[model samples]
Target chain A: MEHAVETTLTVNGIEVTRRIEPRRNLVDFLREELGLTGSHVGCEHGVCGACTVRVDGEIVRGCLMLAVQANGCKVETIEGLSDSGELARLQKAFHDRNALQCGFCTPAMLMAARDLQLKNPKASREEIRTHLSGNYCRCTGYQAIVDAIEDVLHG
Target chain B: MKAPSFAYAKPRSLEEAFDLLERPGAKILAGGQSLVPSLNMRLSSPELLVDITGISSLAGIQVGRTFRIGALVTHAQIERSAEIRKQVPLLAEAAAHIAHPAIRNRGTLGGSLALADPAAEYPACALALNATLVLLGRKGERRVPAGSFFKGLFETDLRTGELLAAVEFPRVERSAFLELARRQGDYAIIGLAGVADGSGRRIAFLGAGATPVLAKGASAASSLEQALKALGNDIDPPADLYHSSATKLHLAKVLLSRAWNTLSKPH
Candidate 1:
């Protein structure tokens, strides 16, 4: 039996194909095979949200989805989203607001907050908090993270 | 942690999926939110995974007198679905409390029920609505009430080769889902979903027992204290690390009182 599964998908606007083990998670695929290591893997069980990325425009846990499942799917990670200038406004706002500390959770936090921005432009503080509750930020305590997204929303 | 090696299969039709499931150590991979995590931790080591996403029949939402939610419907879909928000807001409200948005985007309704984690919100909501679960097997279709569906921890009435087709929920005159967790996205330590319609009122509790506790007519116990006191008989909760049996009971009563008090008020 062929242990490796062949998958073709668009990653950050680039179409790529690879043979990977059926169990290789999307995050590991991005990191090991593609060398796009922006997404962090924390609490691989899905609690920490450090591995959040966009699959077909919706944020999902990269560690929770296998690479073989990415066939024909469009994925947007921190590298691609950043390269595309999609996060310029949120990034600058995060920078100005000092929304990050230690920088471990920044990529995932920005990805998650940006998802809320695209979906709900005029979200309230509570809504932003609820949306961001998935991305764990131990350093900034989320005050700055929420403020960063709110800045992009209002500014 | 890396997942143990496993072969993968994509079944284009339910028939093909059923045949693949007949394999001794094969599992159905729906959203892979819970399963992937377990696989990574080596908690489960299935030899094969039959990915069901390609099965077109398993994905959709049909609204009628009762809503039919396809098994593959993601929690994020439920949270944002206009139909669910309009007809059965109970599901939408409960779906929002499940994990975070990233988790919701991939965690599916069928996967959640099939796994049947005691702390999950969907089971409680299903029980509160008196929803019927549709299961498909080689013999054909079978309908099981949500009350009797969950057998124990991570166990359901789903036979070895049966696939959960969809869940049917009746329209309710009023419904609400309330939960208490340490954080916004964490699983509820104690939660309650209460729904009422012409049929009657029912309250279901999560994190109360081996499965979601369906409290039939317990909300109509005259008073909140009376209802909670009566609920003790229905829920002999097993202790988990996060909450002891007494603590779970206490939280259940507090949440039930709060939910029942709201249900007590005329809608």
Candidate 2:
């Protein structure tokens, strides 16, 4: 069977179409095809949240969704979010709190944090911890990450 | 790691989907939360991926005599739905325990039930609530009770060329869902889903066996102490890497006691 399929979708605010392999995941499509490398790929089996991105206004594991499956969908990566200035406050807070150590989990952490901010701005400390539980940050022991999100939520 | 090469198709209707399923090595793709990971890990490789998310008929929540949830309903949708929170709150509570926000945002109820992971939250909830699954096929539709639907680990009665269209749940006012995991989003080491109705209590456990195990001995017991004792007869949970069989059974008792207290209380 032929593996490549024509897929068209909007990234950030631009619509792009490409003929890609059906097995290529959304993260790879964003990085290799569109030259958007903000979303990192780690533990490709979906255990790690490094490949987190927004699809149709909801955060999802990029590796868990195929590029062909995202046909006609709207995708937003960290670069798009950063350029939009929507993550300014959270990014500042993360910097202020030194939330990142190795910095590998920053993009996904910021995405998950922003999601919580939009959905529940008044989220408690426990809620912040729980919401970010999926995004693994082996550095700073997650204390500073939680502190950063809390600052954005209540600061 | 990346998924092996495969053809893909997104069918807009069940008829079209069934037609695609006729192809050799065709596999249904719902949320792909579990399937995609397996693909990436080389655990499963199919010739064609039949993306069923485009099918409109298989997505929604309907409330009548029984609460009906479409197979395409995502876990996040279930967690945030006011109707599900009101009618079948156990499912809503259970949904919150499934993975984390991102996984929940993409994982579907039908996908979870169809996978029948034994450690997943929906199967035990379905068993506890005595839910009925709606299976659609080329021939017609068939309704299977949750008790009979789950065959074993990562297995279900879902037949070849058939799709789990929806699930019908009879509303039970009193129910409790609890699980013990090392972390918030990790799979439960042991979990309990309990429901109390006029008939009596239906207690089901996840991560306790190859399939969701109904604690018949405990459900039939009249008191908490007796129920705790009877639980021993109901299940013999296999040990995982981190826990021993004895430890799992002990944790199962702890959850049962908590659920028993909650269900026994006057509503």
Candidate 3:
């Protein structure tokens, strides 16, 4: 079967057009087609949060979304969080607190935490724990991850 | 893993999506969090995927005396919905407990309901709240209550070419609560969610059966004691890898006890 849907999506403030398969995952389209490798594909089954990204102001697992589904939607990846050579404040907190070990889960963790904080600026430690429960970090640096979120939430 | 190659369509209207579904082997793409994984695993090999994201009519929260959630509403949409919180806090609470931020962000309420994972939260919420699922197909819309939604393990009564439009939850004077395994994003070993209308009660159990289990008869009990007793008689959880059917039933009983205790207590 073949589908030729010519559509344009404004991703991270950049408009791009593609005529592609509807079954193509958004993560693959981002990494393979658009060359946006910031969104890593881990546990494509949705267990790992490494594929996390923001779609139209919401954090979503890129691996699970179809590229065609994101038509006309705004997407923000880790690459979009920072402008030029500087890092976002949360990035600084993550580094200061040693939140990342393998660094594979950093982008997704950052994206999820960013959404969490945006929704609840004064989120408590338990709240952060409950919210971040969806993103799995195999390196077991959850304490540091929680600490990093705590720093941003409290300080 | 790359999903099997398939045709794609982004329908701008629900009518368009419905027309597209009329095509054979067409699958509706709501959030794609669940469906994509299934497709990649070769669990589903639909020839056409109708991306309903372009159908703006299928999104958003409709507030009223009761809450009606558009089928396309994401997990995040349910979690942050003020109308859901006010009308059915348990549904919001269950949405909050769904697999982490990323999964919730991409998972849709209708998709989850259609997927009908025995361990999924919305099923429990639906069972406990006695919610009605509104489905739209070539024949038009039909309503199925939560009790009849689950046919078996990972199965639903949804017919081919049918699109889930919304879920209507009847308002009730009650408090709600949920308890799941500590797997952290994984399906719970056992889950119990309930709604207590002061004296009467409604309890739904997950992880105890092939699908979300309900003890609706017990929900009408005049007291927690009666409800707890009736629940044991109503539920028949199946044995599986995580737990035996007996164990799950026992867990349901225990959780029902806990739910009753929580619901019967002061706010």
lDDT of 2 by residue, B45-118 (tens): 99999999999899999999999999999999999999889889999999999998999999999999999999
The 10 consecutive residues of candidate 2 chain A with the worst lDDT sum are A132-141
- Model 2 residue A112 distance off true place after TM-score fit, in angstroms: 0.5
Per-candidate TM equals 0.97, 0.99, 0.91
TM-score of chain A of 1: 0.96
Grade the docking of candidate 1.
high
Which ranges of candidate 1 are over 4 A from the true structure?
A: none
Worst 10 residues of 1 chain B by lDDT: B216-225
Number of the candidate with higher DockQ, 2 or 3: 2
For B97-196, candidate 1 gives per-residue lDDT tens digits of 9889888898899999989998999999998888999999999999999988999888899988999989999877578799989889788888899987
Task: Put the candidates in lDDT order, highest first.
Answer: 2, 1, 3
Residue B56's lDDT in candidate 1: 86
Q: Please tell me how candidate 2 rates in CAPRI terms.
A: high
Native A-B contact fraction in model 3:
0.82
Second chain TM-score, each model: 0.96, 0.99, 0.90
